[model samples]
Target: MHATPAPPALDLPAIQALAAADMAAVDALIRRRLASDVVLVNQVAEHLVAAGGKRLRPMLLLLAARALGHRGPDAHQLAAVVEFIHTATLLHDDVVDESDLRRGRKTANALFGNAASVLVGDFLYSRSFQLMVELDRLPVMRILADTTNAIAEGEVLQLLHVRNPDTDEPAYLKVIERKTAVLFAAATRLGALLAGAGEATQQRLHDYGLALGYAFQIADDVLDYSADEAALGKHLGDDLAEGKATLPLIHAMLHSDAATRDRLRAIVEAGEVEAMPEVLAAIEATGGLAYSRRRADDYADAAERALDGLDDNNAVAALRGLARYAVRRDR
Candidate 1:
């Protein structure tokens, strides 16, 4: 029998190590800002923040800032702001999705009550704005404002597509780009801005973040079906249960034969996965997983290319590695 080669190692740990100090600074700042006079606000916000996450978005900002030669308090401030915005979204998403679990733990809405979760999410949004104003840069405020607005718009768009069997691949891609990629783009662009990087460098980093965000979200969608709940940190088939016709499902539907397509359409329109075996089988028969993986790879390649001709350094190398890790990791 022929020998099989092992896959290359993931660079996430190395990237985390490289950015450790700054990430710690960001974490400390997040903790300080999360405090509230109201007990409920404090309890709800702190609960979610205490639940550990990879902090990837904030790390992206810190890394991009350092890569562009910025070492200052402002980057830490903005990184905290980014995290608050992200956490706020999670609180709201759980309430909207009626999700019970996240990160293999009960969701804020489940544990804290839906009203409390929604109110705390609003608190985070307002708190993020307060932090943004402290930065005293109008452009920074502008970018964050626009990015947050776009994310809200994306949420609405996603709601429109729920249980929508007709949702096409382009519509789905647009949702991911707006909901996820824009924030990543804002994070990197903020980094370049903080470093006083020129327009061209900022554009390159922005493109890198945008493409990376697409890759990351697509891979996440794929994992909804393929990953173990423990590894994925969320309920398996949560997307399907929510009637989200993500890339894999969309691709499978497109490639399936008439009978398979009808079965999928009925399942999707009803937003039930009682026939999960049939759905998985159809996806496999149609090569949906392979197609989604290939599409993710293409975006990862674009992200890597976006860094072309930038200054060569550990930060730059980490950014390159991050693009690959976004797609290759199981969780």
Candidate 2:
């Protein structure tokens, strides 16, 4: 791989404006749905929400909606819905992965314990469905319900893949499509649907979101080995340490010598990366990071291609910029 110029940042102010508007609406919805005499519910919900996050889902929804000429308030409500789905997933993810750290901080499961986190996650999931009913849009409900199920299936598949170093790219891609791309597909597809766009336009947005998600998750996997721990806000090589068979390991195995391949395989199968430095070295020696980045690049390009039928707009331009950044980010 050759050195490439960095992708430009989105006018964060623009994204923030999008975030703030969405958050205001989302907050209102959250408050209304969460309003309860149960003190524990509000406390747990607040803890999870206040935990730092990029609000990427809502931002994507806003950008997609704007790209398709949404001038009304539907985007805000929908944006909140997107966030609720994402947050609930995180809550459940921490529980399932038994993760101690996220975004360089203790996860809700770590802080609140698995039971609270899982229950809160359940609350958020049910709350999102309640909000969907308020929208009175059965189609949106179907999309979200289907997306959530796919995500759940993805998580289970990933659980199955752990400690199995032979997990191939095809298997991994299926997990990504479910765990990551489904929500992305839902977010953008909802934007198109809410805007009353043509079916072709709706599908284009859906494909774009799916590809973008693939790029995003692949980049994140690459960063675990390539990025500084400080920059990542978590320990580097966590996935390898956890025995997850991400793209880097899969690609490395494809090209490594027998001894190197065994070493890599052993590390994951052992589920304790005491030899992480050696494993990272082996992966780097075999061009695994480069291979992963290239695959991520292909997904990013696919996302760009999906926009071929959409009318040009700032939101579309920003999304293109974001797709570029997704694969390019160092952390």
lDDT by residue (1-331, candidate 2, tens digit) is 9954333335555556645755666567655766557777787777765665677777777778788888456777777778888889888987877788877778878877899889888888888887788889988889998999999999999999998989999999999999998898889888889888888898999999999999999999999888988778777778877789899888888788998889878888987668878878777888888999999999999998898766766677777877887887766
Model 1 TM-score on a 0 to 1 scale: 0.96
Residue 82 miss distance in model 2 (angstroms): 1.6
- Per-prediction TM-score to the true structure, in the order listed: 0.96, 0.92
lDDT of candidate 1? 0.90
lDDT of 1 at 181: 97
| lDDT tens digits by residue: candidate 1, 42-95 | 888777876888899999898888888897789999999999999998899999
Alpha-carbon shift of residue 45 in model 1 (angstroms):
1.8
Worst 10 residues of 2 by lDDT: 3-12
List candidate 2 stretches off by more than 4 Å: 1-14, 17-20, 31-35
Clash tally, candidates in order: 0, 0
